[model samples]
Target chain A: MKTRLTGRVWKYGDDVNTDVIFPGKYTYSIADPREMALHALEDLDPGFVAAVRPGDIIVAGKNWGCGSSREQAVVCLKEAGVGAIVARSFARIYFRNAINQALPIVTCDAVDGVENGDEITIDFAAGTVKTPRRVFTFPPLPAEVLEIIEDGGLIPHVRKQLGR
Target chain B: MGKTFAEKVLAQKAGLQQITAGQIVTVKPDRLLTHDNTSAIAATFRKIGVARVADPSMNVIVLDHVTPAANETYAISHQATRAFVAEQEIAAFYDIGEGICHQVLPEKGHAWPGAVIVGSDSHTPTAGAFGAFAAGIGRTEAAAVMATGEIWLRVPESIRVQLHGTLPARVSAKDVSLYLIGLLRADGADYCSVEFAGEAINAMSVGERMTLTNMSAEMGAKNAVVEPDEKTLAWLAGRVTQPFAPVYADADATYASVIEMDTTTLAPQVACPHTVDNVAPITEVAGKRVDQVLIGTCTNGRLEDLRAAAEILRGKHIARSVRLLILPASREILQAALAEGIITDLIAAGATLLNPGCGPCLGAHQGCLAPGEAVLSTSNRNFKGRMGSKDAAIYLGSPATAAATALTGVITDPREV
Candidate 1:
């Protein structure tokens, strides 16, 4: 697992719920992550699907992923090749689901200074993100949480621990 | 030192001598709930290369989200679930038209005091009303639990919500929940366990308490619990056969914060469009024209909720310009309403009754809104595009408020009626 990532930014406001991340109506019909990727953020920004480049990161305000506990919301972002998500705060379930899916997310209050399309590099292990102009620091993840991320998620981590 | 209800429950489940906030621990819950998306979970479980569920009897599956096959895809999903249930020999399985999972699980004795329950749906905390530790997990987590019978959790700090004073006539559990949501600010209690106490909460019926726990997720609570007492025991008398002891917070239990709410002065409240935290008193948003009124969900679909609506709509018809849709939370509740004539009273008052399931609530199907319409709902959540169209607006209120709005074709205050 890579601890360093560089990507373009896609900025979003507060309370970006699961409904906009991946619509509820599509819950049943979609299963493939690539198929789910096509509709990611479709409701909030219709052009997001087309404009999003691989390795683009999402920078959001407080309470990002604040609706249903749908893992598809995290899956879609990972499938769409989102490098990482940086938000001021996160709804608890989304934060956990992202960890389960091995999606990198950082909480930084300075997200407001990062503009859309700004090229940024993040050293997750160092808890620092740098833009062309400045650097922002977030608390490093707990050692156990980092272990799960390094193993590519809980499923794999459990497998390794169980020696299965 | 005293332990909070969540701390006590997690400690027992984790087989630890003691546990505190922020410590990560693994627990095998007494029950795991998956509804509507059981097929997806089954697929995930198989993909994980697990031979079989760790304990089939510990898992309960329900078909309520899009029952009666809204489309071929849903029908196929249901078929897959049936096959999976048969293959796994799952102990409890509720088919279509049975009822919503949150309602049926407790009705069938899956919830009890001091029990730890996790479900795939966000509203799983509804069972916490029984003094149990219940929370929601995502599909992959559910699948992982199915395989190993255990999941990890970071112990949450507890918040004490003391309810004092009596509720006004027009005010119901729905109002209390919305009022709390306003104070919690959507993320005020995020990642924390909420413990309900005081006179008002003790005086509330089991159904009312369920409403409170169900909406705890709206404020991002990890779980919501009410300590079981004589009232709780009485409600669980015949409904639950399992033997369990109640867990209570110690007097000296450390708490993150304490919030006190007096219900006597509380009036009917509504959560305005786009966000649940966007709430205001009924009087402030009254007179906004409504195109539809929906009364039911896992949140407010119990028998007491339907009876409240029937009382308000007894002889009066809904406004000609307004559409009213009623859904009972469970099949048993629907049958009880039919016997009590609550269903007839609602229909006679011009309300359309839909099958017992979660269709319109999640914008899946059944009474979807047209663009630019406004609706008053008794269900939880009013996010933009929640009920089909982003252009439409949503107002969440009590069943009484929904009934009043149905009759007047506007966001009329229940008290005014």
Candidate 2:
């Protein structure tokens, strides 16, 4: 995983749950990861999928991804090429899912400092998010989680462990 | 410092004398649960190059989400899951119509005190009502567990909630859960192990305790538990044939915070539109118009919930403008409700009896809301477009409140009815 990266920001408010992140309607219907990306934020932000470029960051208020344990919520964002998600906080299961999917999830109070379309730089090793105005620091991801992310998610990591 | 329930349970599972919060440990879970998503998990498991599940007996598969195949896609998924279960020689598979995974797990003897359980669904913590340490994991990790039979976990900090006094008429455990969620927003207990205690909690039935632990997921809890008592033993007597020891917190266990509530002054609670934490008392939003009233799902779809709704709607028909839907959590719940004539009463009162499964709670099918419509549901979530159209609104409450709202075609206070 890249330790330092820059991206454009897509800002949102508190409690952006799984259903809105990846609508439940297509849950059973869509099986392909690429197709799942098309419906990302279809319910809440309809313009997101079509406009989101690879490496765009999502800056949101507290408790982002607060509902459902569906991994599709994480998959869609990863497939959409969202560089990282920096929120004030995240629901527990979502945080785990993000790591398993190798998606960067940073928890810190950076929502107020950044706005939509702002250019921001994230240094995972430094544990800092540098915005146009200020720099916000978050506790670094645990070493185990970083290892999983570095190995391209848990599936590949486990595969390596099993000598497959 | 003395250990909390989570620390104690994890310490035992890890074969250690003691463990503290915030430490990481790797342990084999007693049970691994997957529902309709089993097919997806199986696919991921195959990608890991595991020919067979490390231990098939540790797996419990349930087919409740969008059951009976809402379409060809869902049917194909279920078909694949069945094939995987057969290939893996998994004996704990529950086919369609059995029930929601959370309800089916404990009922079928998979969950017991001191068991470490994990599932692919967020409400997996419902099994914690039996004094088990149950938490939800994602599909990827669930696949990993299937392949390796072990998982890594971070010991969560504990939050102690003490409930005092007795609930008044028409108020139930669902109200208590909503009150707690409102008090501690959606992220109040994020990644923390929440323990329910005190007189009001001990007074609750196992089913009611299940409701509390089930909704605890909405507050971002890693898991939630109520201490196992004789009631828990009584409920599991026949189902659980194996002997097990129940774990408890130390007398002076350290906690991040302690909260206490008096149930006597509590009123019926409702989680309003867009968020589960955006909650209010029934009186605050009473009499609001509604197009539908859904009384089922993992959260409040048990026999007691049905009885509560039936008690309010016995012999009286629902409002013409409202569409009332009743779905029991499982086939067993459906059978028991049928035996008690609760089904007949609810049907006679103009409630449409959907099959026992997670109908419309996730908005996959059965009852999708149209634009500009509103529903008063007895489910846990009320997120935007959760029931169907983005413009549609979902207000969540207990079964009694759902029935009362269906009776008047508006969100009504159960006590007033």
Q: Pick the candidate with the highest TM-score.
A: 2
Cα lDDT tens digits for candidate 1, B289-366: 999999999999999999989989999999999999998999999999999999999999999999999969999899
Error of 1 at B315 (Å): 0.9
Backbone clash pairs for candidate 2 read none
lDDT of 1 at A68: 91
Candidate 2 has an lDDT of 0.94
Task: Place model 2 in a CAPRI quality band.
Answer: high
Model 2: number of backbone collisions: 0
Residue-by-residue lDDT tens digits, candidate 2, A51-151? 99999999999999988998899999989989999999998889989999999999998898998999999998899999998999999877887889999
Candidate 2, residue A19: Cα displacement in angstroms equals: 0.6
Instruction: Give the poorly placed runs of model 2, Cα more than 4 Å off.
Output: none
Model 1 TM-score relative to the real fold:
0.98
lDDT of 2 by residue, B167-234 (tens): 99899999999999999999999999999999999999999999999999999999999999999999
User: What TM-score does each model's chain B reach against the true chain B?
Assistant: 0.99, 0.99
